[model samples]
Target: MAGLRVDFGLLLEPLGFIKVLEWIFSIFVFATCGSFQGETTLVVSCKGVVNKTVTAAFAYPFRLNTVAFSAPDPEGCGGAWTDIYLVGNFSSSAQFFVTLAVLVFLYCIAALGVYIGYKHVYQQNSKFPLTDLAITVITAFLWMVGTFAWAKALANIKMATGASMIPGIETCKAPGITCRLASVTSMKTLNVSVVFGLLNMILWAGNIWFIYKDTNLFNKSNIISQSPAMYSARRI
Candidate 1:
């Protein structure tokens, strides 16, 4: 039988509090992309006293929109009003999809870890069950998987948007309206949230599993007194 050498000096109190907070944070980030939804200007052109503006709106008030505008250069409008056109719009679905996948994975694992922690702490059963250990291990595995997915997503976005510069797209003339696309490939704020939240969740799951496995062994050894001696023990 495996047993934890309990040190009366060591406190096991509030075993599940940190996990609960991590779970809540992960869920909030997964469900909301509030910062990503807004109007963003991508490209601009200035020529022949003309200026053009391109804007991209994301997760907007429903139905993303991109608009282009061309106006005579404020300084000097002449020579056929060199009209310059700019183009910009919400990033491709591929970008958003990858992000969403990572967020979902983190959310699920964090929530599970928090729940398990709460159960283990409140119940305070000397012999934690195998089911509890299994749950913790599974959640930890998921956090690892989420981390890999997040890396892939970041790589894909970098390749697709490449420093926010449009590939093969030529710059617009100062006076003419030339179309250019702006890249909205990454959300730095959300990325931080995902990374930190996953790290905390994964660690929490590992801790629970470590404790649970030891407890299970103790139970098997009959070291834990689950019931009162009068009812559960046989007198020799």
Candidate 2:
């Protein structure tokens, strides 16, 4: 009689799809700036907050009240009297890039761990190390989503200050201003971050399970060490 053959494709399909999803989402995250629309809506709809109201106040007496201004206010405006710097609210392209870079690095490590675990199981034609598998998958998901959040936050800043479409809008015209100047406008990012944090917690839980197995079960038991006997026992 012919022996049965296992379908490795069935087992590996999901992992491959997840990897592809990561790549697609990464391009969107990195390129789209997270699609953040500016707070012009809020500042316009809400009372008491108009053009010059959202100022970027710098250290000691330097302050740029609006994007229209080319220089800071006169209050001891610091000597030099050189080039003027405009101040405007803009998105966080640099921060988004940095955060996304870190996220990608972490996920690459997680993916490598998963690949190693899968290889170990397949080489012996044995069951996968479920704990390791879960940990790596969960870590990848969290890191991916977190990177998305940071990207969107920066995109939002771009949206708000009308910098999402740069060059058309003057760059560095806004002085001493970094991306994301308002908190009310970042609620979407905050929600995404919360979900990402929860996923991270789940990843940590999986790591704990792995530690428990290594410390209390793997070291003391002869499960894998006597695999042939164990398999025979299962047949009877």
Candidate 3:
């Protein structure tokens, strides 16, 4: 009859403590990247009319190309320009990053529950530690892939929405119509998200060593190498 027994001491161990950090960092990774909403304004100066400020807004799961803003009115610009959209289709990378973070967050919660409440059962069962190690390794790899993709996507998003894009806009190229970027929402939080993502990867990768120690493989190797007599005695 193995019932849940809370063990507060596990919180001090590397396995328990690192899981806590992974849980917290996972939240940060998703909150900063998933909840992000940004806007960029393009100031359109045209002959014979007041300068028009066109605002383009974008948000999480950013599919920038899908986010269109009305081009400066043809009547106002003295020229025709269709709706302009931010560049790039970054949804795949963005969604992958956020989805991984959310899944990792949930995993951390469940892992912590196991660490705190079922510590004894977990230790007595080699399968639990082995599974934990394998999952940790996979998660670390995913974090690395997701973080890099998201970071690259973020850079592209900045370029697509910034002043550099002015030259690419047809209306901006029209004679007597000058366009300049007014402002773009700061991506500082998204940058932090990337940082947290990297940290999560490092933490999980490092935690692998600690988790592996609890696995039967590590114990068997130690018994064979460090105490061959004890190993043979156990076999006999």
Candidate 4:
């Protein structure tokens, strides 16, 4: 059997290099959003008790309404306190964003393999380039939609878990009781994910032109441009 030939030089080309970038950005998008775990603290001070801390932990998918934390011990607080829950249901948007990133990552890996190993076959077959162009366009659109939705969801998450949550807590309304947010997890990485998402969107959208150039339509257009008679006839 003949050995499989690999073209390392393709890695230097626009198609291969951009696919590598897409693969890397996809990893960032998923890792930052999928493996994340965080918590917010509510510090409660009562008339006769030391400040009691209540912590609500949440993670990826961000179904804030489903996450609840126990209130400070009622005996210590000198009044009954109910459990507290974070607000909002943002799982749909978060899940959609993460799932799309993962799919894009897989596609990039497969595309790079084809570029390196079977580039000759891909070039000779017009169908391959046409299919690639179609997929690239769809993926670009998905990145735009998913990234925007996820960004909006992230903002809502910040509001639900931050100081804005204090007013909604019943315990904070009692006389002589004061409640404030002590801390919340930093979303710096998630912010970076959004940035990467935007970059991926732009990269994929730009790549569409390059892929289009590989298709028969681009060649036909070029041929027509080179022949003024053909171009004039076509315009007629």
Best model per TM-score? 3
Q: What digit string (tens of lDDT, one per residue) describes model 3 on residues 1-236? A: 26899987888999999999999999999999999999999777776655788888999998989898766665655555557888888999999999999999999999999988999999998889999999999999999999999999999998998988877887667777777788899999999999999999999999999999999999888877879787777999
What candidate 1 gets wrong by more than 4 Å, as runs, is 1-14, 31-35, 38-40, 46-49, 59-128, 158-163, 170-186, 210-215, 218-236
Q: What is the C-alpha RMSD of each candidate to the true structure, in Å?
A: 10.0, 12.0, 2.9, 3.1
TM-score of 4: 0.91
Q: Against the true structure, whose lDDT is highest?
A: 3
User: Could you give candidate 4's per-residue lDDT for residues 42-105 as a string of tens digits?
Assistant: 8887766557788899999999999986567757466546567888999999999999999999
Rank the candidate models, highest lDDT first.
3, 4, 1, 2
Once model 4 is optimally superposed onto the true structure by TM-score, how far is the C-alpha of residue 141 displaced, in angstroms?
Answer: 0.5
| lDDT pick, better of 1 and 3 | 3
C-alpha lDDT (0 to 100) for residue 139 of candidate 1: 55
Which parts of model 2 have CA positions greater than 4 angstroms off? 1-12, 34-98, 101-236
Candidate 4 versus truth, CA RMSD in Å, comes to 3.1
TM-score of each: 0.49, 0.32, 0.92, 0.91
Specify the poorest-scoring 10-residue window by lDDT in model 4.
1-10
The alpha-carbon root-mean-square deviation between model 1 and the true structure, to one decimal in Å, is: 10.0
